[model samples]
Target chain A: MIKKVVASVQEAVQDIFDGSTIMVGGFGGSGLPEALICALRDHGARNLTIVANNVGGVQYGVGILIANRQVRKVICSFPIGRRQAKLQDTFWEQYRAGALEVELVPQGTLAERIRAGGAGIAAFYTPTGAGTGAAQAREVRSFGGRECLLELALKADFALVKAHKADRMGNLVYRKAMRNFNIMMATAANVTIAEVYEVVEAGTLGAELITTPGIYVDRVVEVKVERRWQG
Target chain B: MQATESVADSRLTERQIAWKVARVLEEGWYVNLGIGIPLHIVNYIPDDREVILHSENGILGMGTRPPVGEEDPDLVNAGKEPVTLRPGGCFFSQADSFAMVRGGHIDVAVMGALQVSERGDLANWMIPGHELGNIGGAMDLAAGARQVWVAMEHCTKDGKPKILKHCTYPLTAPDCVKMIFTDIAVIQITDAAPLLLETAPGWNPQDVQKLTEPKLLFTKPVKVMDLTGAPANK
Candidate 1:
C-alpha cells in the first residue's frame, strides 16, 4: 500500500531550503496550516517568498514569519488589514519601512494565475484591471473591443494547504469557504504538503467526495488544530 | 461624508441608501456586494426577492453575519468577516468562484466608489495619495458583472464633489457604472449623460446639481426618493 503520510509537520517541511517560494493557504483566518507555518518559522529558512490572500494579523501565522524576518516578499491581494488594524500589523510596518517587497495582484487574477500554473498554461489575458494602474508595464490586447491584460502563471516550490480530511494516498477534501486557495495551490506547487485533520485509509474517502486527487498531493500530515475565530 | 444634523435630516442615512439599492435586486439574481455600504445591502433585500449573494472568497448564497458565539472561522466572506451560509449554499475554490464572476454569471455587482466619471468610469480600489490601495476583487466585478451599480456618498467630506466629468483617481474599470445611489440623489448613467432619477425629500435637482461636478440631466419628472421604512423626517 502506498502511503504519502509524513510522520510530523517539521519533518514534512525540513527539506525546504532558503529562498523557496511557498504558497501559504488561508484567506484571512480560515484554512491556515498553522502547525506547518510554525514549523517553517522554526526551520529558520531565510529570504522566503509567500503567496497568500491576506497578510495574517500581527504575530499570527504569516505575520510571525514576517516578524522573524524570514519572509523576503509577499504576493497577495490585500496586504494591509482594515483601517483600524493597519497600524498594528507587521506587514504594514515592514512595508512602510521598505523592509519587505510586495507584488499586489487583483484577487481573481491571482487565483486564475495559480490555476494556470497548475494546468501548464503559460499565460492568459484577463479583462480585470485592463484600464487601471494594474495594467501599467503589462501587455494589453483588445478582444471583441474589450482590452485585456496578459497575466503570467505562478508556480511555487511548496504549498501548505489545510484540509478537513485526506486519505493515506493523499486524496484531499476541503470544507466550506476554507477551500479558497488551497485547491489550486495544491496543484501549483512542486511539493504540496497537506495538513489535514484526519487521514483515512486509501479508498475510504468516497471517490466522488474527493476534490483533490492523490496524484497532485505529495505529502500529508495530520495536524489537529481547532478553528479559532479571527475576530 | 459626515453631515451635520441639519444636512443629515435631508440626506439618506447609510441604512436608507442601502435599502434603496436593495430595491433594485431581482428575484433569483446572483449578486456580488463590494465592501462597505454595499455589504449592508444584504440586510435590506426585498422580502419577495431571493437574491443569491456571492462572495469572491468562494461562497455563494451567503447570508448575513453570524450571530455572536456562532462565528466559524472557516466560513467568511471576501471581507474576511464571519458570515452565515443560507440554505442551499455551496463552496468552491477561488478559481471557480472567479469563473462564476468573470463568466458573466453574476447578474449585478454593487460597489462603493471614491469617484465616478460622467461617462461611468469607476475609481474605488485605490486612492492617489495612498501607496497603491488594495485591489481585491473590485476589478473583476467591475469588468465582468452584467450591470454595475455604485453606492456611495454624493460628495466628499468638506463638500467636495465625487461625481465628475473625469475621475482624477486611478480607474477601477472604464464606463462600468450603470446606476449610482447617493445620499442625496439617485442617478442612472446613460451613454450620453447621467440622468437625475430621484432626489431626497428635502432636496431638489438644482441642490443636487450644485454638489455634483458634472452636468446633470433631469427627467421629465424627477420623483421624490422613496425612503420607505426610513426614520420619520424630523
Candidate 2:
C-alpha cells in the first residue's frame, strides 16, 4: 500500500510557488486547513489563485491568506466579512482598484467543477450560469434538449485539506459537515497535502468510514494543536 | 376577557411544537427549516427517517445538533451555527444545493414568521428595524417547495397581532404558505382564503379574531384541538 510521509506543516507547504493555483478546503470557518494556510502565510507566497467555499473569517483561515496579500484571484460564492457593510466595503475597495480578480460562481457550479476535476473529467455542462454573469469565461452548449453552460474542470497545482483522522496510508475521515470541500479537492490537485488531527494506523479506519482514500493524497502532515483556532 | 388576564392557550409549547413538526417529515424530504423558533425542529426528527436537511450555504443530509464537546469549526448551518452530519451524508457545492432547491426538488419547507397575511403571503426574513435583512434562500424555498408551513407566536411580545390583513415588511414569498400554526391556533389557507381550522383551548373564535388584524374568512365554526406535546412551559 502507498503510504503518506508525515512532515511539519511548514515543510509540507514549502514547495508552493507564487502565482500558483491552490485549492483550500473548508466552508466558511469550518474544516479549513489552517496548518497549511499558516505555513503558506509564513512562506510568503503571493499572487495566488485560491478556491474555497467562502473567504475565512477576517482574521482566520483564508482571511489570513488575504491579509498577507498572498491571493491574486479568488473564485467564490460569497464575499467575506462579519457584516454585510464590511463585506461591501472590502469588495468595493478590491474591485475599484482592480487589485482582486474575483470570479463569482454559483455555489453549486463551483462545487461541481471541483468535483469534476477530482473525478478526472475535463468538463461538464450545467444550467446554473446559462444567463448570469458567471457565463463570461465558459463555453455554452445544448444538452438534453435544453441550453446548458459548459464549465471546465478546476484543478490546482496544490490542494490543502483538513480532516479529523487519517492513516499512514492516507485514507482520511472527516467529522460531520466539516468534510465539505476536502474530499473533492483531494483528487483535483497535482500535489494534495492533508493536515489531519489524528494519524492512526493503516486499516484502523473502517472501510465504510473512509471519506477520501490515500490514492488521491500525495503528502500528509500531523497538525499541531497550537495553530488551530476557533472562530 | 380582561386585558391583564393570562389565558391558557392550546398551542404546543415551543418544544412540543418542534417535535410535532418533525414527526410529520417523511424520508427523503428536502427541507428548509427557518431560523429562530423553527430551528428547534431539527432536534425532533426520528433517527430512522432519511430526511435530508438543507441550509442555504449548500449543505444537505444534515443531522441533529452535535454534542457540545464535538463542535467542529467547519460544520455550520445557514444560520452560521455549528451542526452535525448524519451517516452517509456528503458535502457538495452550495450552488448545487440551491439548484436542488430552485429546481423544485424540495418537498417541504417549514419557516418562522414575524407576520403572515390572511392571503397566505409570508413576511419573515426581515423586520423594519433590522439593518441587514438578507432573504437568502427563503424566497427560493418558498417558491420551490411543494408545501410551505409557518410556525410562530400568535401575538407579538407587546400583545400586537402578527397575523395581518397585509404585511408591513417586504414580502419573502407571494401567496406561498399552506398552513400557519401558532401558539393559539392552526390556520389553513385554501382557495376560499385563510380558514380558521382550530382555536386554542379556552379561547373563542371571537378572542382569536380580536388579536388577528386580518378579516378572517371562517367558513365553518372553529373547534379546539389538543396541543401537540411541545416541551412543557418552563
Candidate 3:
C-alpha cells in the first residue's frame, strides 16, 4: 500500500554508517528533528560530515552530535555562534583544539548549493560572495558587469528533517520559518528521513500544500517533542 | 572643542543612533536588519510608515518579539531570537528566502560594521586573523540589497576610528554601503567621496572630522541631528 513509515527513530537511523555526509535540518532550534538526532547520537555513527545553518546552541541539536564526537567536519554558514562563545561551547573547543574541519560558505550560496544538488545541476555562479574572502581560491565569472563566484552543488548520504505533517507515502508539509533548510535538504539526500508531528492517510494531505513530494522522501516517523524554547 | 571632552560627550547612545536610522527608512520598503545595533532599528521605525522586515532564515514581514510564554521556537529571526510575524507575513524555504535577497527584491539592508572605507566598502563578518566567524547572510544582503546602510558606533571602545581610508579587516562586500549612521554623525557615501550630511548636537564638522580617519568632504552645509523625541513623520 506504499507505506514508508518507520516503527522507531532507531530503526530510521539504523542504516547510517561511519563517514557519512549528513544534512541536519534546522535554523537555530526550529525545525530540528530532535528525537532523530538523539537516536543518531545513541546509534553512534562516527566521523560524520554535517551541513546545517549553525552548529546549534551548546546543548541543542547539532551541538550534542559534536559533543559526542560523532562529527568530523561541518559545512555551514555560521559554525561559531557569538552567544555560544561566551559559554565556551563544544564547537569552539574542538575547533580550537584543531580536531574539527570547517568549510564556511555565505548563507545564500549554501542554500543555493543544496538546491542545485537536489535538481541534479552540477554547479552555479552567484554574486553572494563574489568580492570577498569567500571568493578566494574559487573561479570568478562576470555577467552583465557583476562578478560572481562559482559554488558547487552539495549532496548528502542522508538528510534528517522535521516537518509539521506527513502522509504514509512520505509527502511532507512544514510550518512557518521552520521550513528553512528542511525542504532543500530533503531533496539533496540519498535517503531522506522526516520526523513529523503526525502521519496521515496517503490521500489526506492536500496535493497543493505538499512541500516535499513523496518521490524524494524514503521514510517517515512520527516524533512529538516538547517545545524546547518555552523552558 | 577638546578631543577628550567633546568627542565622547557628544556621541549618541546606541538607542538614539538606532532611532535616527529608523527615521530615514521609506514607507513600503523591504528592509533587512543585521544583528546587534541594526536589530534595535525596528523598535524606532516611524508609526506612520509600514516597512516590511525581512529575516534571512525564512520570513518576510517579521514583527515584534512575542510576549513571554507565547514564543514559538518555530518562528525566529536571523539572530535566532524568537519573533512574531506580522499580519501579512509569509514563510518560505531557505532557497526562496535568499532568492528574495539575491534577486534584489529587498530594498535596504541595515548592517553593523567593524570597519568601512570611504569608497563604501564593508567589513563586519570576520576579523583579520580569526579563522572563523559567522558569515550568516551579511554578504548576500550587502551585495544584493538596493541600498546598504550601516549602523555602528563612530569609534572603537579603545578610541580608534572605524571609518577608515582602507579597512584593515577582511571585506564583507566591496562598494556596497550607501550611508552610515554612527553615534556622532551621519555620513553619506557618494560617487566622489564620503560627505558629512549631519552631526549630533554640540558637534561640528571639524570636531567630527578629528575623530574620523578619512578627510571629510563638505559638498553642502551639515545640519544638527533632530532628536526632539517626535517621530520622523510627525
What does candidate 3's lDDT look like per residue over A4-107, in tens digits?
99999999999999999999999988898888999999999999999998887546778888888888999999886756653355666788887888988889
Give Cα-based local distance difference scores for all models: 0.88, 0.73, 0.88
Candidate 3 residue spans exceeding 4 A from truth: A85-90, A228-231, B1-7, B230-234
lDDT of 3 by residue, B1-234 (tens): 234665446677878888998898989999999998888777888778899999988898898788888889899888888888988889999899889999999999999999999999999998778878789999989989999999999988887999999898988899999999998899999888889999987788998898899888964679888788833421
TM-score of chain A of 1: 0.94
lDDT of 2 by residue, B37-156 (tens): 677888888778877887765577776667766765666886567777777666754445656765778788888888888778877656787433444456556655678898888888
Give TM-scores for every candidate, taking all chains together and pairing residue i with residue i: 0.95, 0.66, 0.95
Deviation of model 1 at B92, angstroms? 0.8
For candidate 2, what's the TM-score of chain A, rounded to 2 decimals?
A: 0.89
Residue B193, candidate 3: C-alpha displacement in angstroms: 1.1
**Which residue pairs clash within candidate 3?**
none
The TM-scores of chain A alone, one per candidate, are 0.94, 0.89, 0.95
Evaluate model 3: give its TM-score. Answer: 0.95
What is the C-alpha DockQ of each candidate? 0.82, 0.17, 0.81
Candidate 2: residue B194 Cα off by (Å): 9.5
lDDT score at residue A141, model 3, on the 0-100 scale: 96
Q: Of the pair 2 and 3, which is ahead by DockQ? A: 3
Candidate 2 chain B, run of 10 with poorest lDDT = B1-10
